[model samples]
Target: MRALALLWGCLALRASAALTCPKEMSGFEGDTVTLRCTYESELRTHPKYWCREVGVFISRCSSKIFSGENSQDVMEGRVSIRDSPGELALVVSLRGLTLKDSGKYWCGAQRLGPDEACPVSLTVVPATAPEATAPEATAPDAAAASPPAGSSRPTTQPDSSSSAVGDPGPASSSHSSMPSVSIPTTRLLAPILVLLALLLAAGLIALSTHMLWGWRQALWAEDAQRGEKVHLPAAARREEEAPAQAPEAEETSAPCRSEEEEEEEEEEPDPAKFIAV
Candidate 1:
């Protein structure tokens, strides 16, 4: 019976400990809201502190009103923390909060004894005002202003009467009006004829250049043929002159070879003369 009672007590305590801070809470720009956190009997020894976490940095705001000794900056003068006569309350009065103040706030409870800290989340939803522009206010009024909501008077404008007479009818047969159109005539054909004559002269010049190039090419071909015919006679004369010079040059060279052969024969060592020496 004692063991069963202990088990039941543990289960009940676990169930009660599950109650934590609210997951999310939001308020208007000029309103006040409480980021709430409470403890079960198991965690009553630890005091709870509500803090704001912005980009891995945590700032402590309120604490200890829920249970044990805790600290907060609000305990000074930046904010006010109050516990009513009966309610376990954390009232945070924010003044004119903007979107910059919106962030993840943490309600962390640190145990008095050696125990791990537990934390819950609080999301601040800062209110926003409808955007306005000076241009929007100064724009032309599309619709006229309405009367007071309860008034029964109609808003329609009064009908306007015509003041101008009708247009004068077509002119009588006594007078006739003729509209005249003046056409500008240019002496353009004379300039165009002059430009065509200049173009014809340019074409004649280009044709003369082509004929001159052909005549130059024909003269070059004739000169080339005459040079080829003269080359044969010139080469024949050079060949005849070369044969006449060749006889004299070879006659001069023949004695050198003969003298070399004679010197070689005379330089042969004689066996009998060598033995006498």
Candidate 2:
């Protein structure tokens, strides 16, 4: 039974070295980030070391420990280690985390009288959005309107004294009761409108350039075809005129070179009637 217990303890120690971190880790700035390292273990006095592995070097982390009363600078204050010391889970609190605090961390624990250790990966996520504030206009202006006295009204009017007179003017009462309303101007949005118009103009320009290029290409092709046709006829005419012999006279009569012409050549041999026989 004692041998069996020793074998079981050895198995548990081997299992504790297989501790791993969680798959998903997310936390906002100024929030707590828990590096979950779950493992199987039999010994509770073994100390686990958490380090940040950057590139090829491992740096020591000064965070809290689950050994009850032990804590470091990085692990002090709000920082805490899990209740189950054998589990090897760690929690680090960043009071006001900034962008520079993002990094990857790893946790490991060494066996007591042997050369064996386990490690797990950890991720630190910083906040994305900026802090919120009361919604207020960044730029406020109220000098667009002028009164009948040819002067701009003050942005804030002072409280008036008690008057012995009758009802105040409607314009005066209205202006005093209401907050100054600054009218929106087309000039304020001119840059955006101009940018939109320029984009449209650029599209039109590109389309026109494409159309003109296509038209020029078509016209060039047509001209090339016509020139080829003209050159072919001229070449044919030159070939046909290759066997030129002479420039004969322009005569209206037919040529006299056949035997029928010999009859015509020999004058009419008029013969008297053959009286004899």
lDDT of each: 0.42, 0.43
The sequence of per-residue lDDT tens digits that candidate 1 reaches over residues 36-117 is 4444455444444444532112123332323223333254323344322133333333344444444444444444333222
Q: Cα-based RMSD of the predictions, in order?
A: 30.7, 19.7
Off by over 4 Å in 1: 1-19, 42-46, 54-78, 83-95, 113-257, 262-277
Candidate that scores best on lDDT: 2
What TM-score number comes out for model 2? Answer: 0.30
| Candidate 1 lDDT score at position 34 | 49
TM-score of each: 0.31, 0.30
lDDT of candidate 1?
0.42
